[model samples]
Target: MMLEDLYRLLRSGHVQAQGVVDTITQPIIVLDQNLCVVTANNAFIKTFKADRDDIQGRVFFELGNGQWDIESLRQLIGGIIPRAAAVIGYEVKHDFPVIGQRTFLVDARRLVHPDDNSANILVLFEDVTERQRHDAEMDFIVSETRHRMKNLFAVVRSIAMQTETKGRTAADYRDTFLGRLDVTLRAQEISVSNTPADFEALLRQSVNPLGAERFHCTGPSVQLSNSRIMPVSMIFHELATNAAKYGALSGQDGEVHVTWSLEDGPRGRVFLRCEWREENGPAVTMPEHKGYGTELIQATCAHVGGMVELKFHPEGLNAVIKFPV
Candidate 1:
């Protein structure tokens, strides 16, 4: 019903007005020209955890430890309502005594009784805390999706540029590039999926094709965040590829041992430390220059706030990768 109709009912009689106001679901209050509470709806009493007897005839600002004494609300009631006759959707955020934090869209309307020259202000409260939180969550999801897409594109471009095409035919180049792309896409899929990606599972998947017997892996269970998954997956893929080509996996008697642990770093930061050690491999020596694989590994590690250290000992190739979890 209109504010005028409600006001007319309220002016008619207190007993009848109480019944009518109680029917409304939204919390409402009627205040005299002096800002004293004339009557409050049952919804208002329930919503604010107030007693009707205590609120009636009390000043609005003095009620409930001065919670209602907000400066903006004072302005809306004293200054704006007098001139505008109505103030719609005046939002207020406050920590109420019993309700904790809440957001409300307040609508105030000035009411007049023509016969008696009486004036009162009608205030309506709409709880909008949940709606605001949902809106914020949607905005975050949209921003996160855009950011992930941009990063995915950049990663694809870098991988394409770094994939070596020299000393390879068109088919070989296509296979090599596509293999890396597949690994990247798989990582992206896992990162965006509803289920969290397991670090050990990811490592195993990257090196599983080389025969499980050629490698031994052990690590405590670790779950990776969405932002870290792609880069970590790429690091694992590169390390496995390099091992299969030039390290332990290249020889029949060689074996690779992968182990990882979580450690507390300086300043209480937790870090993931992984070691890739090869044994019984052909004599190893440091390359004269860094190859695309090595660069890719280093770049991916740096992308995730991590570092990779490679050691080409005479016996085998050893790598230590460290990054914040």
Candidate 2:
């Protein structure tokens, strides 16, 4: 082709290339062999908050007050671009004046001009802030859930020891211990089948035998881990039992209110605070000695790193339990 025809062809290619780069949604920049920014797409300017005039033709490392001059990144691109097809999934964390600390996955490839054999680097950036945040939250939840499960298992071990002390023989111990174990296992199964157990559903199941009308349960829709379900259900069971035998649930007009709320606690940690308040019941007196039921409730609460306060008020019985969420 003639020189004029070749120039026209190159000019057409440049226009087509610019149109392609401009259409990309991800931040993209073209850099020369010396790491000088040859051109940047619209997405690049918008994403990094840079002007076309300020970035185009400038050294990439000097852009944005040298924010792009990452040492490890420079080494990565310098070493990989020449020998390999591309350097893919290179992570870069930068704090821009316009945007706070952000994470980006960068891909760089060598773009060669066939006519002159001159080469440039085409770099693409994908923002992964939301993905990283979601992964971190999921990891935390899994870890905490595992810790809670371990604590619950420890509580079961303690319960076995306590129950063993009251048994007359091996057979008696087996019967009593297994009976309590069965309750825990059943609760565990229920919770496992429905992971992140619904607070309202668990409460309803625990007090269903005592008659739902005897208890008024009100709380926000909160989900608790499987480990949390058994201990909490047991506490509710104990409360319902005591209510039916001696507290509010004993009388025809008596009632019990079980309300809970999630609130910020000390040091900015969040916790769930639940209250079991009885009303219009037979007068109650504080027990001098802690029974198995009381001990079980206290032990379970302590195992989960929680606090329980029980008050034998003249009007009725009130118990409050609070634990981290």
Candidate 3:
């Protein structure tokens, strides 16, 4: 019977029995004052895998080999329903005999007949397995985002404090700090997007602005880990900036060569070896003291468990960076 018909039956002071429940697609059951099943809808029959004849007029707990006879469930429907107006949003998660594990959100309401003081309990079941799974995934993503943001803030704080210590003047500090910050932002973008940071891609992002034709690079395809991507990119940014200002990239005839390889190391470890060579530039001379850019490169390499050797040849600047993989 449809709800319209059920409403008519109620108006005529006649209970339509279980047939009225079939109107709802959500698993539903009409129970008497004793909590015995009066009638179950088609949805309930299919969801619980029960015969209509076995369920009608039988106690709800006695259905499906007594799988529904749980302590918490009894407390909700048996203990609370008789005394309270209704029990709304009660959740039940259990494995049935043939249906396997499932989650359900239950809503039970006590309905008082207009003609009599006697009441009937209408229980509705909503399958929430998929909803709960989606909610769990969302929660995990939120938690991971918080964790990454915290880590990023820490990294920025470290950079600020260290830059302040090494910077010679406000101008130097602004330029150096902003350059390093750009590298950190790139790493964060890659991590959030869940994309692999290709070594070539990061190199281009750092140096291409200086001039794509100013540098020559040769290396096999390598994807960098999140922890290493920021530090490595910062190292390249500092080197490229120095080249653009004073090294090979400073002149039209000057250029830089960058090569890298992965090799086996002692103690069964792997190592990444990279070399930056510059040529055809102004006569090279070593600085009397370490500059902010040099310090930035060294500190970044140390953060990622790597080492860098900077040397000045008459031709140009040569730097070698190595790290364990």
Task: Please tell me which predicted candidate would have the highest lDDT against the true structure.
Answer: 1
Give the per-residue lDDT of model 2 (tens digit) for 188-265.
788758668888887887778777977898899988887788888877877776788778888888899989999998
What order do candidates take by lDDT, descending?
A: 1, 2, 3
What candidate 2 gets wrong by more than 4 Å, as runs, is 1-15, 79-86, 113-116, 164-325
RMSD of each: 7.3, 9.5, 4.4
Cα lDDT of model 1 by residue, 86-106, tens digit: 779999899998889999999
Candidate 2's TM-score reads 0.54
lDDT of 3 by residue, 1-325 (tens): 8999988878766445444657668998888878899878899999888898888888888888988787877777765554756677788898978888988888887765677455678789999988999999999999998998898899888888777554267887777788778878876777667766788888888899898887889999988876677777888998999999898888889988999999877777677899999999888899877777888888778777778899999999999998765
lDDT per model vs. reference: 0.85, 0.83, 0.82
TM-score, each model?
0.63, 0.54, 0.83
Pairs that collide, model 3: none
Q: How does candidate 3 score on lDDT?
A: 0.82
Off by over 4 Å in 1: 1-20, 79-84, 112-118, 167-170, 185-203, 210-291, 294-325
TM-score for candidate 3, residues paired by index: 0.83
